[model samples]
Target: MTSEEFGAAPTRGRRLRTVVVFHLADVTGPAKSLRPRLEAIARRGGGLDVLAPAEGSLAGAYGDLGTVCALPYASLTVPRTPREAARAVRSFARDVGLFRRELHRRRPNVVVVVTTALPAALIAARLEHLPTVVYVGETFPSRATDGTVRWLGGRVIARLCEALADRLVCCSETVARQFVRLGSTVTIYPGISRIYAEGDRAGFRARYGLEAASPVIAVVGNLTAGRGQDTAVRALALIRERLPGAQLVIAGLPHPRPIDEAFAASVHDLASELGVERSVVFTGFVERVADVYAAADVVVNPARFDEPFGRVALEALTAGRPVVASAVGAIPEVLRDGRDVLLVPRDDPVALAEAVSRLVEDPALRDRLVAEGSRRVESEFGEEAGIEAFEGVIADVLEQRSNGPRSRSSSPG
Candidate 1:
């Protein structure tokens, strides 16, 4: 469909209300990333109908955005055993009937689902003969010790996304490649906020008691084994030999999962064992990630496993700092090696340290990387892309439906 077709949607006398459903609790990473796009939908004489599970901190997560209501999905905040997972699935099936009733009552033009919630939402939207767009982030679950049940469940969810959804939008090209079964897919980077693009470097350093040239190296994200914080600490042990006063900053919060907290403690213990304990700082769960990026001379996203998108690397680049990251998953698709970012081998502390050292020693190299990174981030991942892409998909679906009724078995092209 042409871009011009997007703006042709009717929104004069009456507004087009949009409904979005996701199985989530609280305003975590995903909520924060897509909230801007939701606001944009609201700005175009449209409304946001948020349908999430009523359990946990969801009430606070969506706080006064659109018309918030509850769907009977499973709660992650509660103890999640295999039995609980099954119960949640059964509950979701039950909720589908209620949610379909809500859609009919609300009569939204389209439905948008944020990832795995697609199965139930798609089924409900189909009952109402409404088109759906599924926003896919991680195709598979990421955990250090992912039991077979969760992994198998993720596969089931992925298949449902393929079989039921009309259009599947991916968070990055990597995700698009891994999940292009039957639906037409598009890539839209959930760009970082303006605070990262314009944070105070000097002030952030001061707030953390960092000297003007202490050479801070930062790793930002949840404390997890797959994220590779331990590797960052080992790299710091290597970084300190060259720049003795160099520090490693770990900025993130641990999840309620025991493994997540245990992983955080393991990272700290590794630092001590390496005799770089004093140089490493663990800033637990700071909301201000841009500030963490600001305090760093070099930022690292050393993900051991492939990720859908390395958001921390994006934030670091937005903060105008040189970034060193592993060439895993969709990271290379977003940031180029030796251009916007420096890519290293996964789980190699020696390689990680060498890359960080190069940025520290070579001021000219850092400047080259920073300039390229800023330009790439601006042109490619601009503020409006997320909202615009979503709007275009919704518009396309509406326009197609206006042309004729879609066959129930017809796959999206």
Candidate 2:
């Protein structure tokens, strides 16, 4: 897609109306990143309507930008039992009918499915012959432990997406590479704002009982297994051996899944085992995440998995705090090793400790990383950049649909 295509004025006929279908109604990473894009649609005199599973924080936030509709949908999950598989088929068919009815009633010009998890929405849009855009944000895991059943399920989902959707907007090139067989794929980096850069440093430190002069290390994602909060805790113990006044602040809540909850408990247990529990603070969920960056001197992202995009690392750089992250996935795509962020090996506590300690002790290195990181975020990952890229994709899809029908082999049905 060219700049002229994306920057062109809206077609001078009927008004453009878009309906976005999402898998979850919670305040998740995808929902947060998509807010600016939705706003851009409204700014271009396009009507917006959102469909979600239920009512939650995301629904409320999107209500201001568009008409929020509560439509239930289920994700395609690998079921173990025979009964579970039967029920999954039933639920999927029911939800597809629901979505098809809703789309027919709304009569949108184009349909946007926020995540690849919602295959039903793509199928429904195809049945209606409406142009569709699906956002591919996650990479399917092909590890041995994932089990053959789950791996096959992932392949099925990818094939369904490739067949049904008109275009796939991937979050990063790493994610796009996974869908090489797909006909149309675009990599649009999610944007971040400078909201995190403005906060009360002294007030946040006082509220969290952190010493004014102590070195504070923060990890800002949800408490999940691959998030590597346990690694951060261990790194804190190693850092405190030299700078005894160091503190580690963990600032997000876990998902309701049993595995995630267990991982959260294990992180606390590991901190206690290292005898550094006293130096660690667990603030479950902060309403204003800017406060966490304000109280921290350095941020760490020791993710063990192939993170599709490092939003926390971007936010830290935008907040003007130096970052030490694992050199995995698309992280190295946006952040450099010495210039923008200090890249360390994944799941290695000793290496993570050394990087965090080096940044804390060397003020010149921290300043240089922060300066370079801020410049990169402004130039490439600003809010306007994402909006323009997404708008371009939408325009291209609409134009193609107007010209003729897209060629595809099969549908989910």
RMSD each, Å: 5.6, 4.4
Which 10-residue span in candidate 2 carries the lowest summed lDDT? Answer: 1-10
lDDT of all predictions: 0.76, 0.84
Give the residue spans of candidate 2 off by over 4 A.
1-14, 405-413
lDDT of 1: 0.76
Residue pairs in steric clash, candidate 1? 252-285
Error of 2 at 74 (Å): 1.9
Backbone clash count for every predicted candidate, in the order shown: 1, 0
Off-target runs (Cα >4 Å) in candidate 1 are 1-14, 26-29, 54-65, 68-72, 75-89, 101-106, 141-153, 403-413
Best lDDT among the predictions, by candidate number: 2
Q: For candidate 1, what is the total of clashing residue pairs?
A: 1
